[model samples]
Target: MVADAIYSCLPDPKEISPVETAPDPEDYQFLAVGFWVDKGTADQKAREYMTKIRNKKIGVFGTLGAYPDSDHANTVRERVRELLKENDIMDLFLCQGKVDPELVKMMAETMKDDPHHSMTPERRARLKEAEKHPDEDDLKNAQKVFEQIMVSLNN
Candidate 1:
């Protein structure tokens, strides 16, 4: 969704999703990379693409499970930024992404019997406190952020 917005803003955008293959920097002067956060950083494929990019104009965007402004999210952002190397990282657009609740439930069930499971009072409270997020505002804001980066880069 974010990529679609960024692509629309561009004079000519070649839409591609980097998965098993990374876009060759030689094919384009500028690149927009988007990925989902995993364990406080870009997932493995995105990280692979990031390392391959060097000395190019780059726009970064992604989604995360954590609220955009939370400390955990901020720390993840910092770690995400670290993914850039030898490139001009123009900007980052972050938004909350839906995580599979089934995964969470599975974890809870699987760890319920684990001796090492730390279902501390605090952890339990935090889990309960987390609410459904990434409303329309988050999606809109992410698109806006990507558009702004495109405008700035064009200038």
Candidate 2:
């Protein structure tokens, strides 16, 4: 499994399974976590671990990514924002020792008001549908509208 391989590669590797829940941020300096491209067993397993971590009131969680520019990466980052807001937990998301600048900008832009975001008609329709739901899943559903526009104009 990807989680097993990552743990094997880590310096202080621990055999963490989804069944084992994590403690709160108050209990630890950081809640280290991982994800995989294959969302079958890997994704389900990771979510179990994250759910346990979230239940502990631990807001600080880290995610290591293979592709930083992938939509899944964007989804994870956006999901973290929704988690923080929902849990009433204030903490930083660190990829390593340093924070991700793109994520920071995304969070900031999300908090601010903007009118001229480049939303295509189809995307707008999806956003409208997401607005109807207004849940964590919906947040994930509609992030492309924000994520695409939030990227550098140079691209």
The 0-to-1 C-alpha lDDT of every candidate, in the order given, reads 0.73, 0.39
Best by TM-score: 1
lDDT tens per residue, model 2, 88-133: 3433232211224574357446744544433445434534443333
**Cα lDDT of model 1 by residue, 1-155, tens digit:** 66665566666646566456655776888888888888888998888878888888888888776667788788877887777857888888787766677866776788877765545565455444443445566557766776777688769
Residue 2 miss distance in model 2 (angstroms)? 11
Q: How close is candidate 2 to the true structure, as a TM-score?
A: 0.30
How accurate locally is residue 150 in candidate 2, as Cα lDDT from 0 to 100?
24
- Candidate 2's C-alpha runs over 4 A off are 1-29, 40-42, 55-66, 80-155
